[model samples]
Target chain A: MSSVLRFRDLTLGYDRHPAVHHLAGEIERGALLAVCGPNGAGKSTLLKGIAGVLRPIGGRIERMGCEPRQIAYLPQAADIDRSFPISVFDMVAMGHWRSMGLFGGLGQARKLKVFDAIAAVGLTGFEDRSIGTLSGGQMQRMLFARLLLQDAPVILLDEPFTAIDARTMADLVDIVKRWHGENRTVIAVLHDFEMVREHFPQTLLLAREKVAWGDTRETLSAENLLRARRIVEAFDREALECTRAA
Target chain B: MYDYLIAPFSEFEFMRRALVGSIALSLAGAPVGVFLMLRRMSLTGDAMAHAILPGAAIGYLLAGLSLGAMTAGGLIAGVLVALAAGAVARFTALREDASLAAFYLISLALGVTIVSLRGSNVDLLHLLFGSVLALDEATLLLLAVISTATLVIFAALYRPLVLETLDPGYLASVSGAGAPTQLVFLCLVVLNLVGGFHALGTLMAVGLMMLPAASARLWAEDVTAAIAIAMGMGVVASYAGLVLSYHAGVPSGPVIILVCGAFYILSLFFGRASGLIRLFSGRQHLEA
Candidate 1:
C-alpha cells in the first residue's frame, strides 16, 4: 500500500525537550492505525505533528499525496471549551471550513449535509441545543458528526473515546470502520487496548520512541507492552539532550 | 411623564450629545464585550482599559485634554499593552493573564503619576470619570466613526472570529486564520475601549463593554443573539442612566455602569441560559 504519511526521524516537543523523540514511521493509505502509549508517551504530540499543529524539531513529516487541509484532526475533548455560545449545528457545520473558506455561506445542500451528519450521530433533535448543554458522550458523538462532514482523506483522533460511554464508543467505532471502508487513512491516539485490538488493524506502540509497529496482534504482544512501559517509566526527566543517532 | 423622560435629551444639547455618544459606544463596545466575555477575557478587557490611561495622560500633558490627542494616545497605549502582553505570554513561561495584569498595573501607576504632574484633582477626576454630559461635536463624530468602523470590521471578521474563539486548534488545523483573527479581535477590543474612554472614561469603560455582555450571555444561546441583546441592554442602560443622572443629580458614567450592574444581577436569576434559577429547577427536575 502507498504511504499517506512518512515521519523521518521526527522529534516533537515543547522547550526543546522532545515528547516524541526520533520517531520514524509511515501511515499507509487506507490504513486504520491505533497509536498506543502510556502517560506522556507523546501519542498526542505525534498526532499533532502529523496534523501540522506542532512542527518537528529534528526531522520532517512528509504528506505523500494529501494537502494539509485534507487532514482532519479531532483534538481531545478537554481542549475544547463547551460553554461557548455555539449550537450543535454550527459546530458540526465547521467541518465544511475548508470548502467554505473563511466567509462562505451554508447553502441548502451544505445545510442538508450538516443535518444528515447530526442525525447519523443519533443527535437528530439536538440541532438547536448549545454544545454546553450536551453530555460528555453526546459531545463526543457531535464531534464525530463534525468529522463525518470533514470527509478528509486523512483523519487524526486524539483520545476520542476518553470519558465517553460504551454505546457512543460503539457508534463512533462504526463511523471509523466506515471511513476505513471508504479508503481514508485513520490514525488515532488511543489508550484502550481491547478497543484497539478489535477495531484497528494496524498498531504503533510508542514510549517516546518506537517500540513496535505493524499488525495489531503482534505489535500489542505482552513483551512489547512490557518493554514500552519500562522504557516510559525509566525515562529521565532531566536528560539534557537526545543522544540517539539520526 | 413624556416631558420628564424627553426633556433631558430634547431640551438640552449636552444631554442630547451624551445620549448620542453613549448609544454609539453601546452599539460598538457591547459587541466587542460579547467576544471578550466569550473568550473569558473580561478581566483582560479591564486591564487593557487601565493600560490606556498612561497614554491618555501623556496626551493630556502634551495637548491639554485635546480629544484627538488623548484618543490617539489611548488607542496606541491599549494596543501596545495588548501586543506586549501577548508576546510575553507567547515567549515566556508566564501566562497571558499574569502578563496582562503586570503590564496594566505598571500602566495604571504611570498614568496616575503623569496625570498628577500638572493637572488638578478636578482634572484627574474628569480624566478618570470622563465628561459624558459635556461631549463636543468632535468627540461625537469620533464615537460615530468608531462605531461604524467596528460594525464593518466585525461583519468582515465574523466567521473567522467565531471559529477562532470556539475552537482555535481546529481553525489552525484547517487554515492559517488563527493569528490574524486574534489580532483583529484585539484591535476591535482596543478600538471599543478607546471609544468607551471618550464617554465613560478609562476606569469605567470596560464596565460598559463587559457587564452587558455578561448579562446577555445568560440570556442568549447564540453569538449573534447574545451580541444583539448586549447592545440593546447597553443602549437602555445608557438612556436610563442619563435620565437618572439628570434628575438624581449624580455622575452619568457611574450611573450607566450601575444600571448595567442591575441588568447583570437581574439576569443572574432570570436568564434562561445557565442562570441560577434555571440550574436549580433543572436539578429539581432531574431529581424528581
Candidate 2:
C-alpha cells in the first residue's frame, strides 16, 4: 500500500551544513515509525521540515491523501515554559485554530472535543488550572489534549517524552498504539531505544543521512546503531545518561 | 485624611489631567509590559524609549510645544525606526537587540546633538525631569483616545499576540502580519514613551512599564490576572508619585519611576511566586 507520508531523496539543512540529506522513506498507514539516532542527528529538524516548520532543501516530501492543516505536529516544547501564564483550557483550545475560521474562536462542538481530548489524556478538572502549576507529565498530557482535538490521521512528534513522568510516557505510547490500531500513521523522533523496542515495531534509522529503514529489530542493529551514533551531530551526554538510567 | 482624598480631585486641571493621563498610560502600558517581560523584550522597550529622543527634538522644532504636532512627528519617527528595525532583523545578519540598541542609541545621540545645535539655551531638564502641571486639554484628549483604542485592540488580539510572541513558527503568517497592525502596536509603545516624556518624562515612562508588570508577575499565575494587578499597582503608584512629587517638589518623572520601584522591591519580599515571605512562611508552617 502507498504510504501516508513519503520522503523521496529529501535533502534539508540550515545554510552551511547538511542536516538531513538524501533521505528516502515512506511511512506506512497505521505504522508507528520511530526515527532513532544520537543527538544532533537532525531528527528534530527532519520532523520540523515534515511539520512545515522548516522547508526541505531538496527532493520531495509528499502528504498524499492529506491536507497541510490536517497533519498534526507536536513540536519540541523548547520555547514553552512551565511558568507561562496560561490555562490548560486555553492551551488545548489552540488545537482548534483552523476550525475557528479566520477569527480564531472555537465553535461549541469543537469546544466539547477539546474537553474530550483532555479527558482522553486522563487530565480531567485541569482545564481551569494554570499551566505553570503543572508537572512536566501533566504538561505533556495537556499537549495530548490539543493533539486529540486535531484528530489528524498523520501524527509527527519531536521527542515528546523528554523529561516527563513514566506514567505519561506509557499513556503516550498507548495513545500512539491506539492511533496505529485506527490506521493512522505515526512518525516520532525518538532517542530512547527501549521506548521504540517496547512500543514501535517499525523504525527509521537516520543520522543526517538515511542509514536504514525497516522493521525495528532489523534497522536497530548494533552496527547501524554504531553508525548512527558516530554520525549524530551533537554530543548529548545528558540524554544518554537518562537513557542508561531508564 | 480629607486632604488626601479631596485634594487630587479638586486640584488644578493640569493635576486632574496628569492624574488621568498617567492612569490611562499605566493601564495601557501594563498589559503590553507584561508580554514584553514574558518575551524578554523589555530591553527593546528601553531601547525604543531612548530612541524617540530625536523624534521629540524634531517635534519640538516643528511645533515649539504644540502637542498635536509633537505627537504626530514623534509617532511618525517612531514607526519609521521600528519598521527599519523589523526589516533589518529580517534581512540582515545583525540580531534583534543589537540592531535595536544601535539604532536607538545612535538616534538618541543625534537627538542630543540636534537639540544642542537648534534649541534655545538647551534646558535638558524639561525633557528628562517632566512637568505634569503643564498638560493641556488636547494632550489629555489624545491620551484618552490612545488609551481606548489600545485597550480595545489588545482585547481583540490578545490570544494571537500571545501565541505569536511565544512561537513564531507554528502560527505566524508569512506576509509580515501587515504594517498597520504593527504600526499601531509599536506606535502605542512609542506614544506612551513620547506622550509621557513631558508629564512623566522619558526614562521612567519606559522603566515603569517593566517594573509594575514584573512585580505583578510575581503575584499572578495568569496573564489576565497579572495584567489586572499590574494596572492596579501602576494607577495607585501614578497617583502616589504625583502626590509625592507635589509634596516633595521633586521631579514627577523620577518620582513615578521610584513608585514603581517600590512595588518591585515590595514584590521581591511579599510576592506569591518568588517571595521571601512565602519562603519563610512555608518553612515555618508544618506540611505533609
Candidate 3:
C-alpha cells in the first residue's frame, strides 16, 4: 500500500521540552492504525503533531496530497466547551465549514447530508436539543456525526473514546471501521488495547519515541509492551539529549 | 401614568436624545455583551471600557469636548490598549486578564490626569459619568451609525463567531477563521464601549453591555434567544432609567445600570433556564 503521511525524524514538544522525540515512520493509505502508549508517552502529542495543531520541534511531517487543514481531527471532549448555548443541529452543521467557507448557508443538499450524518450516529431525534444538556455518550455521538460530515481522506482522533460509555464506544468504533473500509487513513490515540487488537490492524507503540511499529499482534507483544512501560517509567527529567541522530 | 412614564420624553428634547442614544447602545451592545459573557470576557469588557478613558480624555484635551475628537481618541486608545494587552498575553508569561488589568490601570490614571489638567470637576464628572441628557445631534448620529455597523457585522460573521466561541481549538484546526474572528470581535467590543461612552461614560458603559447579557443567560437556552433577551433587557433598562432619573433627580447612566442589575437579580431567582428557584424546585425525572 502507498503511504499517505511521512514523519521524518519528527520531534514535537512544548516549551522546548521534547515529549515526542525523533520519531520516524510512514502511515500507509487506508491503514487503521492505533497509537497505544502509557500516560504521558506522547500519544496525544503525536496525534496533535500529525493533525497540524502542534508544530514539530525538529524535522518534518509530509502529507501526500491534502493540506493539514483538510485532515479531519477530533480533539478531546475536554477541549470543547459543553456549556455554550448551541443546539446539536447547529453544532453538527459546522462540519460543513470546509465547503461552505465562512458565510454559506446550509442549502437543501448540505442540510440533507447533515441530517443523514446525525441519523447515522443514532442521534436522529436529538437534533434540536442543546449540546449543554447532552450526556457524555450523546455528546460523543454528536462529535462523530460532525466527523462524518467532515469526510476527509485522513482522520485523526485524540482520545475520542475517553469517558464515553460502552454502547457509544461500540457505535463510534463501527463508524471508524466504516471509514477504514472507505479507504481513508485513520490514526487514533487509544488506551483500550482489547478494542485496538480487535479493530486496528496496524499499531505504533510509543514511549516518548517509537518502541515498535508494525502489525498489531507483533507490535503489541509482551516484550514490546514491557519495554514501552520501562521506557516511560524510567524517564528522567534532567537527562541529557540523545546523541543518536536519524 | 402617561404623565409619569411618557411625558418627559415627549416634553423634553434632552430626554428624547438620551433615550435615542441609549436605545442605539442597547441594540449593538447587548449582542456583543452576550458573546463577551459567553467567552467569560466580561471582565475584559470592563477593562476595555476603562482603557478608553485616557483616549477620550486626550481627545477632550486636544479639541475641548468635540464629539468627533473624543470619539476618535477613545477608539484609537481602546484599540491600542486591547492590542497591547493581547500581544503581551500571547507572547509572554502573563495571562490575558493580568495584562489587561495592568494596561487598563495605567490607562485610567493617564486619563484622569489628562482630564483633571485642563478642566473643572464638573468636566471630570462629565467624562467619567457621561452627560447622556445632553447628547447633541452629532453624538446621536454617531450612536446610530455605530449601532447599525455593529448589527451588520454581527450578522455577517455570525456563523464563524459562534463556532469560534464554542470551540476555538476546533475552529483553529479546521480553518483559518480563529485569529481574524477574535481580532474583529475585540474591535467590535472596543467600538461599542466607545459608542457607549458618549451616553453612559467610561465607568458605566460596560454596565450597559454586560449586565443585560448576564441576565439573559438565565432566561434563554440558546445564543439567538440570549441575544434577543439581552437586547430587550437593555432597552427596557434605558427607558425606565431615563424616566426614573427625570423624576428622582438622579444620574441617568447609573440608574440605567442599576435597572439592569435589578433584572439580573430577579433572573437569578426566577429565571426559567437555571435559576436558583428552578435548581431548588427540580424537574421530574425523565424515563430512559
Give the candidate number with the greatest DockQ: 3
lDDT of 1 by residue, B116-210 (tens): 99899888887788889989999999999999999999998888888888888888888897898899889989998988888888899888889
- lDDT against the true structure, each candidate: 0.91, 0.77, 0.92
Worst 10 contiguous positions by lDDT, candidate 1 chain B: B279-288
Native contacts, share recovered per candidate: 0.68, 0.25, 0.73
Model 3 residue runs over 4 Å out of place are: A239-246, B91-93, B282-288
DockQ of each: 0.66, 0.25, 0.69
TM-score, cand. 3 vs. native:
0.95
Chain B TM, every candidate: 0.97, 0.89, 0.98
Residue-by-residue lDDT tens digits, candidate 3, B1-288: 999999998999999999999999998999999999999999999999999999999899999989989999999999999999989999999999999999999999999999999989999999899989999999999999999999999998788888888988789878888888888999999999999898889999898899999999999999999999999999999999999989999989999999999999999999988899998986787796
lDDT, residue B254, model 3: 92
Output the worst ten-in-a-row residue range by lDDT, candidate 3 chain A: A73-82
Per-residue lDDT of model 2, residues B127-193, tens digit only:
5555666777877787777778778888876766666665444453222343444455676677677
lDDT of 3: 0.92
Runs of candidate 2 exceeding 4 Å displacement: A38-40, A101-112, A125-129, A163-165, A221-246, B1-4, B80-104, B121-123, B167-187, B247-250, B282-288
Lowest-scoring 10 consecutive residues by lDDT in candidate 1 chain A? A76-85
